[model samples]
Target: MTAREVTKADKAEPGSPEWLKLVTASKIPSILGISRFKSQFALWHEMAGNVPSEPISESRQDDFDYGHAVELAAAEYWRYKNDGWVISRGEVQYTDDALEFGNAATIDGRASRGAWRRIVEIKTARDLEEWGDDGSGEVPADYAAQVIWQQLITGWHEPANIVLWPQYGKPKIYSIEYDAQIAASILTLVREWNASLASGIPPELDDSITTYETVRRLHPEIDGREVQLDAALAHDYLTAVTDDKEITKRLRGLKTRVLDAMGNAQTAVVVDLKIATRSPARGDAIALRSNTKADPATIEGISA
Candidate 1:
């Protein structure tokens, strides 16, 4: 189904199965680094039309955790600001909610003016263990990109603050300033992704290998198996291969061809294709062969 059709039933009414399904589907993708689940939530919020600024407790755990983190951070800000620091709380419109945007993309939490003047996006990081002793307090590039994209969607001026609460220590606040150029570039990329998804075609993979690795690590069951690549892959690939154009092109072509073949096959027949990188004397070649129980004659006829 088209992204539009897939999202048609995504209205955010409390207790609705459609809403619940959207939340559930997003969980796997978000965890698997397949797509930004937050973006999907944001899109759902926009589609649902001005939902009340209350917490949706029945949402996914990861989402709920993020929301709680933001609220706690906001409360902390209130406490600190009340003591003399200038702090403000943005209205929590949809905590881990779904939002649809202009028939293009979906977003996660959609916050606007309520408690604070600007829109707030809350991201949680377990710890800064990855960054050893860089006192500069560097934020991970991926997390930074996420906040910038949210800024582009919400049109917020101030940099979105990332509340980094480690499991072992106190939370560290990281400020993410909005970069117009960067935000614009992200929007452009997202638009292209929307177009491809609408056509039932997956977007070109810029970092297929890295994404494959991430998916494999997160969902062991789906690893080494063929599955539909979604927006999350597109997003990660774009970020992963931002500098390598050649690999990106090849990966995109391979993904498209594979998806197209699968789309045409009969579901009852259960067609399976094994893709492996072969190092031939000439160069690298991808070998595609069926790995199913269907007879050779049937397979040949189907291919023909």
Candidate 2:
């Protein structure tokens, strides 16, 4: 089954309650475990409504607004560069009824040259090395998944393009072709995730920070009660703590030994590899004084 365009009256705004009901393109990478920023467990809780998303900080909100501004500018630049292409800006929403788990996409813009029209996804990056030559279609896996998900929802057989604006270089565009196999796999994963959502189960826990944050939000307050935990779990935790302490002590000794060996040198290198480098001390270290009490006044010469 293919996706259909959403109507204005029915379309929901981004991050709105209605939008949260459907899996979005931006979230596809996380569900597939390809996202660098978010984990599947975290996404599961979000989709299951087990925990609300963390509030965006003002600086983060500013970054988002700046990125959107960049996107608008990039779209306009792309249009100007390609005189023959017809470009339409703003978000276009789509919903796929073919899949049991509802899927949706909000593409950045559309570009049409002659009879070829494709989805346009704009991105901003500080690292230019992550991108490939223009039109090479080599982008970060998470971003590729995002565009592919967009294609899947839009049912666009033509290759989609990602317009990336780097911090220092001119914008580069990568063309991403449709992959039926990957799209099918994504569909399977989404369906399974939807089933988990319906069953009131979440994805298996992970060690990601996002997972920790989600868990914390799941239990915001303590009841001041203790519950007996599994013996093995307690043992494992204690063993890890012991191991960490020992490792930390050993690491400090090793660092001191290395520093002693270096003598006056600052860096330790082995065959072009800089194994260790000491940073110059910035300023006098502040001595910590306990607030509870001050050290007993030092006796000049009469101390016993």
Using lDDT, give the best candidate's number.
2
Listed in order, each prediction's TM-score against the native is 0.41, 0.75
TM-score of 2: 0.75
Candidate 1: regions farther than 4 A off = 1-70, 77-91, 94-116, 119-121, 131-136, 204-304
What lDDT tens digits, residue by residue, belong to model 1 across residues 20-84?
Answer: 33322223232223353233333333223322223555556666666675665655653453343
Model 2 is weakest, by summed lDDT over 10 consecutive residues, at 286-295
Over the full model, what C-alpha lDDT does candidate 2 score relative to the true structure?
0.77
Q: Give per-residue lDDT, candidate 2, residue 116.
A: 77
Model 2 regions more than 4 Å off: 80-83, 129-137, 239-304
- The backbone clash count of each candidate, in order, is 24, 0
Compose the digit string of candidate 2's lDDT tens values, residues 6-57: 8889887766666677889888989898888999998888777777776789
What C-alpha RMSD separates each model from the true structure? 19.6, 12.2
